[model samples]
Target chain A: MKRTEIRLAGEGGQGLILAGIILAEAAAVYDGANAVQTQSYGPESRGGASKAEVIISEDEIDYPKVNRPDILLVMSQLAHDKYIGDLRPGGTLIADTSNVTPRAPEGARVFELPLTDISVNTTGRAIAANIVALGALVAATGVVSKDAIEKAVAARVPAGTVEVNLRALNAGMEVVRRPATGSGDAH
Target chain B: MVGAGGVRLMQGNEACVEGALAAGLRFFAGYPITPSTEIAELLAERLPQVGGAFIQMEDELASMGAVVGASLAGLKAMTATSGPGFSLKQENIGFAALAEVPCVIVDVQRVGPSTGMPTSPAQGDVMQARWGTHGDHPTVAFTPWSVSETFSLTVTCFNVAEELRTPVILLLDEVIGHMREKVVLPPPEAVTVVDRKKPAVPPGEGYSAYDPGDGDIPPLAAFGDGYRFHVTGLLHDRSGFPTNDPEEAAYLLNRICEKVERRRARLTMIESRDVHGADVVVVAYGCTARPASRAVRMAREAGIRAGLVRLITLWPFPREDVARLTAGARRILVPEMNLGQIVHEVESAVAGRIPVVHLGKVGGVLMTPEEIFEAVKGV
Candidate 1:
């Protein structure tokens, strides 16, 4: 009867929807869990606040949309500000420090990482930041296995970009492995 | 029963296309509309690979016309559209209904009166699906709540349409149309397919296209299969020619309506959970059923007797099931994305035997489980 609700919020072109889909595919297809992915987008095609929500459960999922997310990943300042209030108490908040300034809510454990910088430096492209952030989120919370996420990433991304995306995913996990200082105490 | 093997993560729209292909759909004509464009896009890419044809018509009206034409030309044809496009397809849909052309029409519903929120989900077309086309034509509309059901029900739509020789509508709201979920598609061998019953009589052997012998449904003939027949939207006689004789016209119209109405019991599909001995029953369909199901679970945990009766086939509205499910209940709750479309059907079926409450949202936001739970608690 285990269920976890995760929200991935970012600008429209940040690939958050793809990240959510990959995470859902990893959980449902690879991990043998029931998962559903839903998304909301602002009017604009890009540069507008967009959010993708995934609900994973050991049992069949009845309600698909995430209300008070147990895990929230925000890639842009606007997304962080818009969705910060909706995270559950003691929820894990992962944000890209390169683009968003972390604002920890009550009982929220915030992990600030240079997600875009890591993707740009390690993968040589900032376009893989969503994958990088996904790696960090999976590392911070054992929602889905690393192996499953890697397989999902391989199946999802474009053919030629698989290498860089996998590198970006590992770089994201590396950020969480480095030190305890990357995450702030629950406020 | 679909075979239990091939599984994949798929969107509802994508699964619909796969289902259509499995059902022997060889021709598709549609105009791209929000939340429904994926169906056409996939069909455009996949139809050709299967040696089928896909046409992006100038508009929805033309798309429906093309679908009718394709079906007449011995192809299992389909067209997909959203709210505004659905409105435009109504006239031609009625044409298919009257002309007894077997075709599937997929309406991935979006919010609307006219050009409303293009991206938002709404079940506002419940009535439109049944009565959008003019006159008292019998309509068959299947609504699916999940991606897998979308696949199976799309196949069902084609089968029912082909068997009955009438247009069928697969009503899917935007949420189910766009939401991605895991689906294990049964192997193609396990799927059941039904093609339209062609005329048994030879071209010159007194072939009347509208003649069904003892049954209500007539055996349809392809346009160029040596079956010289006239097909028209106007009321026609047994020969398929337009008739001024009142008796022939009445007989034709009654037979068309009875073809579906007489088989209503078999056509209606419903799913009920924990309904027996429950004091409160929630009637829901499509994506709304997801939250209603959760709400029923929560209500049961909280020591409330709540049950769920989900409608899988909307049209030919399962009146008997509605009455049976709500007969002993103290209250019946109908929650839908529209303000109050299906609720009317529930009320009419219940007929004040129970207090039917309408929990509706027209603001394009899905009703959450918490909201439904609160409604259950209030009851």
Candidate 2:
């Protein structure tokens, strides 16, 4: 089976690290696949666009770090500017229309979503934007099974916020489930 | 969240704390530091519930002191720290070594001469772990490559410390300390826990703190156990009393070194992969082993006969394994996170029998498999 590499990047407090962990757990813990996760550490990760990387494969993961990501999720303009070149030539690019204005790649497929707006509309809090983005990614890519991601979401999110996070997750998933209405775009 | 059945996602540091607890650790004292703080954080909440004690002491020195004191009182004790704190605790660690105290110290390594990078992973402390403390003393260190192995290796650490009545180091790089991985820890019955042997003779009837009594390691008697014995850093005789006599001092030092050296082979642990037949071998440990193994596979697929020797035991230097495993190999490559710390040891172990190539990266990034394979190709 082919290996998939994913990179999630945004501001320091955007919860991309936790999102990376949840995604890895979905693949490895819930779906019984092989996955490895690593995050930027020390000064560069703070007061700047922090980053998290995950690699998933059916075979054993050799190199732990993401050399070139097959999928890139950028939640901020700084992240897009920093990690844009790292995506494969025709890879999938998920951008947050709420903050990022992506400089379109030569042949990349892009999905621009109002992630923060969806989180606000569904959960009444913008902090769940990461979850909403996760849900949308799962819907569009089908990288892991829906059942696997839901189990991971329930297990990872805090107890009191689980219900809302799942609601936010489903709300985000709905955008890609029926994206013809314009909340999400395929360009 | 620990001791849960089946598979679960956990970080390396968290698994280490749970392992120590399962190995009957009942006391912990540490000052929090990057890369290793998670060990102390998890232990603070969990130790008390297990009827153990956890203290966030004023500093790393005090933390080591507390560990030694607690262990002397008959409780399994531990302390965790990073590079800077690790430096601070060296004197106390030396004290524990000279005193023959049974305790565990976990050093989650980071880039450093001193505080170079607080959270970036580096294996710069390899030599420090062996020689940082100020004397000719015995040291045992374990380096685990994965999270699950972190759990089991920690259990082995406590066991070895108690069995030998010596201080042990669980040397962890920052990546292994912080990376979260899927793990299914063994049931309590499956894990082995060792405690220091107590004196069989009646307390006051006949007991010498440093007496070897038919063996190299003297059975340690916990304080307040009605056995009176002295303990000090100064060279001491069988009575545990400080002695300037050259003969007694020489014997005492020899006995301590012999205790660890004699068991070095039995304590040696490693994972060999097609090493005996491969034309080229890579000797790596801890986090570095992951990529080195991958590179070995990459080499073989490309028609290069490459193998790997992943070191589980860093101290006591597995010379025999290195020489024997790579005897047929034409060349040896050593990749490490530091500037050739273990590579030098590998060179020494190989003893010019074969050309040894060194790959060292020290700016806070793990060596990529391609880079390691590139060297294999060059070799």
Candidate 3:
């Protein structure tokens, strides 16, 4: 069975843990496959560094820890520096253009998206960046379906917050898919 | 014998999923912790296919609590967690002991007092499994060195849990949890599956779940069976009511401890290879057993006549069997992940006759084969 390993890293308040859980639930429950997700958090929950990894496979997965990440999504510069070395030699790297400023590592596909800006514009929220990044990850890897991710989000999040995160996810996916590359960069 | 079919390359944690499925485990509740998340994740997907239920509870405490609740309702239940999570479940585990609930708990132990190394291996929880919870209670703990053994031992855990009317712990560590190896599933009749004995008396006749009259253990009546009885953490009499009397307290506590301790002959299981004619014995368990096996090969190749003793069951300590095996040996080397847990037991058993040297490593790294061989040098 094919296995896809994805890592989400950011400052603690960005909800990287919840995003990874939704991504894994989408793969395991909705997609009818095996999914293993594990996370490591620092002492503080809000501003300290955090990271989570989700592995989806068609067959039974053996090792849960992702020694080498196939897709690395970093929302902050510290996360990029902390985990860029753990990415596989030829892998996909995605980052939030607003907060993460580190250039992508060589020998891998790189996509820069306005995740934070899109979250602010679409939902007027900064906390929904994780779902937005997850949306971009879904669009980029096609590992888990958009419908599955939405269902997982609806299953997990509060009723009032579901629609905002779904919209943020779609907005993030759309902004990254488009080729517009000028003043909106906000750098 | 285990058949070659259902053969596939699996890690120890994945094998635990297969073993639990084969043993008729229909419900699982767990939290996603390092070294043991695959069991929860695999069950989440597979349980639905098999008409079973899988729930990811709020934390390890809730995960174990939900499993106990599910077990009381007559479902075969289990929970998987690592060292820290296992620590959190201790009080509830003691509750299960007093309540006499039959369920399985898998502790894929990593190095830690508190999150020491999330992704490394350690056998530091050996003694904890025996006495982690408060007060004295009977525990049946199994340790598997290989991926396939992990599967078989999980089934064994369920079987013993039902047979003994208590919680059975499958104590594994990160090396076995993460190591990849091929496993073969046994045929139906080859592996023995034991279910809890039902009460001989009618439901209205007052059946006691904790009643062990003459035998080491008594049958447990599942809840909702129309059997009326009280369960409490305090020491209780034959009718299962709480008591403060010293005589009743001592009787209840000793009965609980001796029920398993008295059956040590049947309870203990070990694996010994080339140990009969050896001058030195290398005693190990869990992941250290793997390298110890390799060390035996290296020592034999170098004409050192070293033998290996691997423990399949860790608690109740397997004292008699260990003593028998080391009867004539000049020295015994005990290798484990922690500083000196199991070595203490071996030294006690050898009675200062055979020099019991310890080879250990902590904080998530495993002791190497060369280090073990060095410990056996003078023997």
Q: How much is B270 displaced in model 1, in angstroms?
A: 0.7
- lDDT per residue, candidate 3, B147-210, as tens digits? 7789888998998788777898999898788654445667767777888888899988767766
Candidate 2 residue-wise lDDT, A22-112, digit = tens: 8898988878887778887436544665788888788877667887888999999988998899899888889988989888688998888
Judge candidate 2 at residue B284 and give its lDDT: 91
Q: Could you tell me the lDDT of residue B324 within candidate 1?
A: 91
Write the residue-wise lDDT of candidate 2 on B322-349 in tens digits. Answer: 7888889899999999887988888888
Q: Which residue ranges in model 3 land beyond 4 Å of their true spot? A: A1-187, B1-5
Ranking of all predicted structures according to lDDT, beginning with the best and ending with the worst:
1, 2, 3
The candidate 1 chain A region of ten consecutive residues with least summed lDDT is A178-187
Residue-level lDDT tens digits of model 1 in B1-379: 1112444678999999999999999999999989799999999999999999999999999999999999999999999999899999999999999999999999998889898888888999999999998997989999999999999999999999999999999999989998988889888999999998988888777777788887788888888888888889989988888999999999988988988989999999999999999999999999999999999999999999999999998989999989997788999999999889999989999887789999988978888999999999888
lDDT of 3 at B216: 58
Candidate 2 residue-pair clash tally: 0
In candidate 1, chain A reaches a TM of 0.94
TM-scores of the candidates in the order shown: 0.97, 0.97, 0.68
Question: What does candidate 1 score in Cα RMSD to the true structure?
Answer: 2.2
By DockQ, the candidates rank as 1, 2, 3
lDDT of 3 by residue, A95-166 (tens): 887887757667887778768877888888888888888888888778888878888778778778878878
In candidate 1, the residue pairs with backbone N, CA or C atoms under 3 Å apart (3 or more residues apart, or in different chains) clash, namely none
**Chain A superposition TM-score, candidate 2:** 0.94
Lowest lDDT block of 10, candidate 3 chain B: B1-10
